[model samples]
Target chain A: MAMEAYQAQFAAHLPKAGPAWLADLRQAAAARFSAAGLPDRKVEEWRYTNLKPVQEQLFALDTAPVGDTPPALLQDSHRLVFSNGVLQGSADDLPDGVRLAGMAETMAENPGLLAGHMGKLAQGQELPLPALNQALSRDGYVLAIDPGISVSRPIEILFLSDGGASYPRNLILAGAGAQATVVEHYLGLGGGGYFINAVTEVEAAAGAKLQRYKIQQDASGSSHIATLAGQLQDGARLENFDLNLGGQLVRSEIHMALQGVGAEAALNGVYLLRGKQHCDNAIQMDHAVGATNSQQDYRGILDDHAHAVFQGKITVRPDAQGIEGHQLNKTLLLSDEAEIDSKPELQILADDVKCSHGATAGELDETGLFYLRSRGIPEDEARQLLMTAFISETLAKIDSDAVRGIMERLVGEWMAA
Target chain B: MLEIKGLHADVDGKEILKGIDLSIGEGEVHAIMGPNGSGKSTLSYVLSGRDGYDVTAGTITYRGRDLSELSIEERAAEGIFLGFQYPVELPGVSSTTFLKTALNAVRRQRGQDELDAVQFMKRLRVHTKALNISDDMLRRGVNVGFSGGEKKRNEILQMALLEPHFAVLDETDSGLDIDALKVVAEGVNALRGPKRSMLVITHYQRLLDYIVPDYVHVLAHGRIARSGGKELALELEEKGYGAFVSGTEAA
Candidate 1:
């Protein structure tokens, strides 16, 4: 069905008694999206990663109820299931002092609270995907942690998309002095082709801590574009790790703003590509205050005709004195046809700040390969070992043991394929 | 156990190891001493089947098989070991893991079951202690951040673990002090047995004093110019390669 037909069907299925505020926000967002349309290569930020596949493709929106959920993908994960766009199921073992539920429930219970935080951090501006998600999203989840609360187990949000186009939106609010870790997994089922356009807005209050792990392992024919925007207040810390292993075409845009003094942010990602798959990771960090620190590291391994793009920009405003930021992007091209384009930029306006950026793209070192081969290891085994080592640095940063194990297995399976 | 008959090799279109011949019987150790650019390193690389070295002429027979026809790993599995002159440092591969893999690979090639982790660790600890290599070095990446002497000792540790039928030590004593040289030489001497043969390549006779070769040969301009007993090494040490080369040219 065309996008217009899908939108009409979606509007008819929404709850009639839904809060008026949410209805108004949805309608306004739809108008904005229709006027702006999907992003194109003409946009500077989207220049390297074209969205033609996502825009041109038509998807049937998954509005039906989600049935039985599959077994937990990883043990020890707190499963929060979202069927179509509605939150349908949740695991019993949730961390203490944490409140998580479907978006509609949260909005109905606390209407003013939902109205205040939603769409505040991610305004879309020139980016159209976030706006599109905000307009078309039916229902999702909200995770909230009170002040001074610390959760030991990771909150797992599983977004299972049926064979239809789905827009999922999440709003995460970490109160002051609260600490939490969450893992958001996006997966697909059945042979139905679908597109997942998602936007997650994170707000870390003063002295709060938030660690997020986003795993994208959708099917080969699926298209996924996610925009994660984070705002860190004074004395707050945010660590985000993204592992993209499976997708036909994936573009992940992460934007962070250190709005308070003494705030710190760490962004790390690893993408393993094979066959004709294409994965792009674009990140931007804005240091708006003084005495802030930001560090970013992303590595990729490309095989066959796969292509990987990494574009990172670090902007140090004039008031952001005493800021220290570092960015590094490195890639290994396993085949002559595999392509990788890395662009790392540092724009500094403060003299007291120290900022550095580096980008490197090359094949595996012949000397290293020869050294391994001379040890009686076969060529394939040697390549596997080196590739594993190449991405181990990023994998080591995951604090959750169970999540790390799952990520490792996923990476191994992708490499073997 | 190993014989080289008129081995001629070239690296990058320039011929080295020109018409060299030598033979090593079981349990015997021979030292090849020469000046810089005398092809001491080239012989080691060619014997190990390293790339970029073209064996344009001659043949090498190991245990009555054509050794030159094998790949590097094949030769390694066949009990031929080459202690590199400048050991390559591989970051992120632990020394213990690397040695265990190589050891098991060779063993499997020889149709033997691999050693269990417990047994491998025990054996590695013993050899590492003998070579005076610290446990920390084994846990870290192979030879990465290791000092010159540490890298040389690690090479000896690998040599001790592999236990090849024939070993080639290329300048193992190049960047070592007196104490390090003694330790490495002791490691080599401890591996000496009736079934093993060694070809020690060096520029100085100091290493030979510890390993104590039964025969010594002078390699000049990629060919063996002179062959003699251990006394020849002493004569050359006293008179230098200048005298030998000039005398050979004059003759």
Candidate 2:
């Protein structure tokens, strides 16, 4: 009843009419969500995640303008802003071969682009969150890079929500041999009693290189749930990094399908949480073809009563022989009350495949602590140094120096806090 | 100047250093030699303020201040250095960064201006060269992938850079070849001065032969069984630790 109440309120924000196929897609998604409702602890994929707190809040749709437009992650980049749940004015200076537009606006002008990738990757109807996101998404962005074109600057989407709810359905389509970077940044506004359920679908065509970055800094009184479904063609590469620094309750699920030979996916993330925060990250790396690679490296630094969950699975199909997949999850527990639940599963149906998974959680190294403090470094500084060292292994994977520097500064701020 | 009066300490609630008394003035270097399990290393750990080496009953007065009142880093800030028997390997922490942080922290504690990067590197270069250490070694993680000799050399390099007034070398000569021994001994011999004092703890007389001390105290069980001049190490070396080890039965 609570979910239904919010769903009706969110539907009022969408236009009354769209194309027939798009309308049909929404109806089917709505039916699926109504049938499934909210997933409970019984759901195997969400065993470590609890939606009870989310169900009780019954967040409303507040249309008032909230929060300042945060500055661009980079000084020189294409920017898009979505206030509450609606897309604001567009970004300027786009390259000649790039098409970036809001989903609803794009449907009216050019439905052909949204026709192919709107719901192709995330076909699973069992997940209620994505189903609800598809049924209600109206103003998410659509970014398409033409074939053989390369965008020099990153495209940033700032989703600022306050006292309300927002459902953003995003699409990132990379043509053959195309390269671009897309950043989905979520910020909370006005003490943030908001709910954000976002779904992003990515299609990396043959030989395309796509880098996706998600920085979730939702407000302390909000719940941010997001899902990413990506499909890679031949020789395509996917590099994704997530920095989860804020939010009271957050869950990010990533499903990557390596459908093309020579395709690769490297998903790395770091969650630095404190207070009563709860963050869950689930990744399912599917190797559908042979000779593909996938790697998942995540680090969690939890203090106070924070709880973190990392569930990474590498599934190799029977035909996906000669594939290499590895995963590692390490956590640093800075407080006795802090907790972590880590499960790394590997289901390899193919022979001659190389796969490995590792998960470790513990406090800071005592010997290393003494080694630093014994030299005049204070206790807190020494702990911060070790925490930085622990996460540097994951941060080193970021190829962009500017992005890495900014992320490092944010990490420092979190440490100082 | 440092003084230890009626020193009693325990490791894991087991008494190790029992009612030991010793005193050293400025410009003095005292060598504590003993057989295995004589609490030689424990005394050094207690002096450095390492946790778990509890001082049950004693007074460690350094420059007329209680050493127990200060923490490990506080002791280091107050010019106390411990050259460990086995130096820890800290991966992912560069020697330059580690040393710079440490030097600045110590400087801040000592009411001295922090060294700028240029000044820090200049000082780092002087000590690395004096210790026969290469510049590349400082670029790598502190003691990471370092050989046994290199770890000890790094310890001495830290000692030289920190410039502690009272130093404790706990088995600093444990695992070095003759060539490395000479290089390390030369590094230690170079730091000797009338303003600095040292307490060298070793199981063998070979190290005492190099970093020659003004006083040699033979420890048996938990207390100092014998104290003599520099000739006492040679006498113990020739005769072995038979008399000292036997004296510990009643100690």
Candidate 3:
């Protein structure tokens, strides 16, 4: 079968093994990946987004390191390069009380902590890509913050794919009463066919706070699929935001569970697509305890023949009383051929919980357009203003200035083009 | 100061204003009273250059220039203002910011020096006080969550700030209470001078009490059928529009 070929190719390209547990995890993930294969239209979660483009391309399992990386792409932020899912260099200017090391080094130094939380956040997912990520992931960055410490600067993790299909798995664990912010960026080079299958897991202990930002800006003709899973303890807070501005066909999944009482979570995202690109965002939140709150807001702007899909769901357990949850997804279609499909759902078993979900898909308001035009603003400038305002409402929620500035610039450039 | 010769317009493919003619000189206030569906709104929209209201035939001359060739903003820059019946609600864009932008835009078009923040705020405070609008209204979004009466007063406040040479008030007094109406009319009357002209469009004679018109015209169907002095407004109010409607139908 085609899945066997991909698995064989992937196995041959993986880096040499470092330790027993790391090797065992890679093998198990590969086996699950081969058995499950790539999800198709029949899968309920991926019904709106088809993976045919990814399956049709022949991807090499190994990537050769770049001789000289392009300065234009890596000019803005501090670069953390990784090739073949292995960290190639170290980063400077790191904040105090924060540590970053390769996955192998962390596994050997802190086996108990890694074993307690790694791979536990994404257990029930049947997707082949996430399973493959867990099975074949190699050396990635590991960040650990001390208790009650807050870092002002954002820590950037750059995963680079030079060639072939690459899977970089990252694990982040925040200690009790600790606070920090991190940004995970994925980029590829050249027109050589590439695939980036990435997975990241975050854990926040009691009274801890974590802000995570993910940016997927890959090369043309490249395919990417990523999953971000998080677990929050009692009195902890987590804010997750994703900006998908690149990739020919990209699918992102975010799953969070408020496992402890008084915990809160916010999920915000924005996607800008043009040409023949396709992007999908799927989110799920579970309220397992009482007095927990969750909110999800996602917006998309599609042009040309591009397509976008948003699927969000909130589930409340029987004992999760006094829970407040809400979700909204709105899309703006710019071209006649552009398409957007949004699905929002809520399932509650507790009688004392409040939950609501809404989805809207429409074109620009003619009245609003005329009102702007009547004021002397050009048609193009008026459209740009409205689009910027729509996206800024979500971006303003970010707590970090540097991260929000980078996102605003990126979105502005995309909209201007 | 303003002239409309054989003005014809249509909305959604149906003709609304058919061959209408009117003219107003400087320092003159004219009131146009008409029954419902008499194309008063269509005339205002056409004059302001709002899209979707097709001006198929006719010529509108303002200050010796063809008004149809210019855009809404250009018309605004040329000192032609139209107070909308239903002002737009622009969330996240404060009323003060909107007014400042518009004021500077018009000023820039006229080759006038722009006002800085401090200078602009001073002028804005004076106008707000004259219109009896609190500073809180300017801080909030333009017309968002505003009551009907508040919206009308806001429109007048804008008129006061822009200081247009000629203005077309499109049913601005329809939803206002008596007190709000007097305030709006007072604001208008304060702006009246020898160099300015106004075209007040209304359905009833109540607004004419505060801002009395020098000339009164009755618009039936699409064209003006009768023109007289201010006493004509009282005559139309007492006799009702039945005479005008039946007279037109008979003709």
Where does candidate 1 clash, by residue pair? Answer: none
**lDDT-based ranking, best first?**
2, 1, 3
Estimate, for each residue in B1-251, the C-alpha lDDT of model 3 and write its tens digit. Answer: 89999998999999989899999999899999898888888888888888889988989999999988898778877888888788878765678877887777778877788889999999999988988787788888778888887888888877777778889999889889999899889999998999889999998899999999999988888888788999998998888888877654321
**Of the candidates numbered 1 and 3, which has the greater lDDT value?**
1
Which candidate tops lDDT? 2
Which candidate tops DockQ? Answer: 2
Q: Quote the lDDT for A256 in model 3.
A: 90
Candidate 3 wrongly placed segments (more than 4 Å): A1-3, A56-61, A64-88, A93-96, A104-113, A160-164, A187-193, B112-116, B247-251
Model 1 per-residue lDDT tens digits across residues A231-271: 99998999899998767788999899999999999999999
TM-score (C-alpha, index-matched) for candidate 1: 0.92
Candidate 3 chain B: minimum summed lDDT over ten consecutive residues — where? B242-251
List ranges where model 1 is wrong by over 4 Å.
A1-17, A63-69, A83-86, A93-96, A189-193, B243-251
The global C-alpha lDDT for each of the candidates, from Candidate 1 onward, is: 0.83, 0.88, 0.81
What TM-scores does chain A show, candidate by candidate in order?
0.93, 0.96, 0.92
Off by over 4 Å in 2: A1-17, A56-59, B247-251
